[model samples]
Target: QLGRCRSVKEFEKLNRIGEGTYGIVYRARDTLTDETVALKKVRMDNEKDGMPISSLREITLLLQLRHPNIVELKEVVVGNHLESIFLVMGYCEQDLASLLENMQTPFSEAQVKCIILQVLKGLQYLHENYVIHRDLKVSNLLMTDKGCVKIADFGLARTYGMPPKPMTPKVVTLWYRAPELLLGMTTQTTSIDMWAMGCILAELQPHKPLLPGTSEIHQIDLIVQLLGTPNENIWPGFSKLPLVSQYTLRKQPY
Candidate 1:
């Protein structure tokens, strides 16, 4: 079990911090200890009724994870007026995405290494626990006051191997996504996360996303253009996917 945290009513909601796909985050302070925390306002009504599956998965997994590299999911609360669900999470000053965007110069080699290493450490833990961070965009990587990486937002995250043959091929965010996922490859592995790690590392060099593909087809075009097309010899059974022929052939040999 993880360490203990106070109840929901203990914190005072400060202001809306940011907004994302699943929810909105707010800055809050613990009325008891005066410590700050981030509160995530998740939309539950959109998913029919009751708690959304995404929030459910996040709560179940985060309650079990006791790691410094991962964000602390403190509590789950229901809004008083609207019944919207909110997740009480550890406070982070900023995210890697905003930092990268606001940077005047590219991250130094050592800085990039440090950032990627922390991310790897977090991913290593999650992957070891059979968890896949389906959405690992830069915005999801939060930085603490001491410059540590906390893997947050398990809304799209899931624990695989629950089923031997996982049927899901479409996961993960676009820019930092792995080639295996982008190509609609079967099987999920730590390698998929590593591919994203490579892209994250590459992004730090220029302060720009390495593969900023807008959509799956354009993403594939960028991939084939940058890394060249994957053939059956390289990525065996490449032609078997339902979406393999979604785009016109890029002339793999070109």
Candidate 2:
């Protein structure tokens, strides 16, 4: 597939847009077509292995996914060196995180609803296709000048099947992480993404993170403080999780 890919030299980097755990994104213009696009240079500086597993998975999954609300991966382009790989993606004007930080006022209720609706539609398509966006946060969502919302960043995403396999509970950002993940649940499902959606929804109205926990323990305490403690009556398997015994429960009645 790399042999068929166009060279990264074909795209002119306009400016650096953002950086994440996996890669650095650049706003670029395709010289061949004179079209604007986002060039995501895969970070392989520390990897002794050929290509990072996360990048491989992202490339594979993005190639198969096609939805209006999902960021489009146009193609994979190689740089001058073999290890210098870049993903050509559909360009968006801005991300939600930066937008929220720069805006003088919070989003209107109708605008928030529209953004959430678009994200939900994208997530529904992903879930239907058996893919779980393990990292679902405001920064991962982008918006075009025309007000179209698209979900980006698939480095932590995974495809699941019947008899779900165990995955790491340490995936999502701490602020938007689910309670099940915080309690050390290994078997992740679509519910984790939904939990994050709720957080995003709440954040949109206030123009700030809903649960800005400093650490895992603080995060759990915040959840307990907001919703009260969970018990056997509220959560059937509450006591069975691996790390449940590690933390003492605050007897604040739910």
CA RMSD, predictions in order: 3.1, 0.8
Per-residue lDDT of candidate 1, residues 1-254 (tens digit): 11243345666888888975578889998797788989888776556566677767778999888788899987776544335566778899999999989988888899888888888889989999988887787888899879998888887777778443553767778887776676676677666667777787888888888889898888888888887777788777778866677767587553
| Best of the candidates, lDDT | 2
Deviating ranges (above 4 Å) for candidate 1: 1-9, 185-187, 252-254
| Residue pair clashes in candidate 1 | none
Measured by TM-score, the strongest candidate is: 2
Q: Cα lDDT of model 2 overall?
A: 0.95
RMSD of 1: 3.1
* Candidate 2 global TM-score: 0.98
lDDT of 2 by residue, 112-144 (tens): 999999999999999999999999999999999
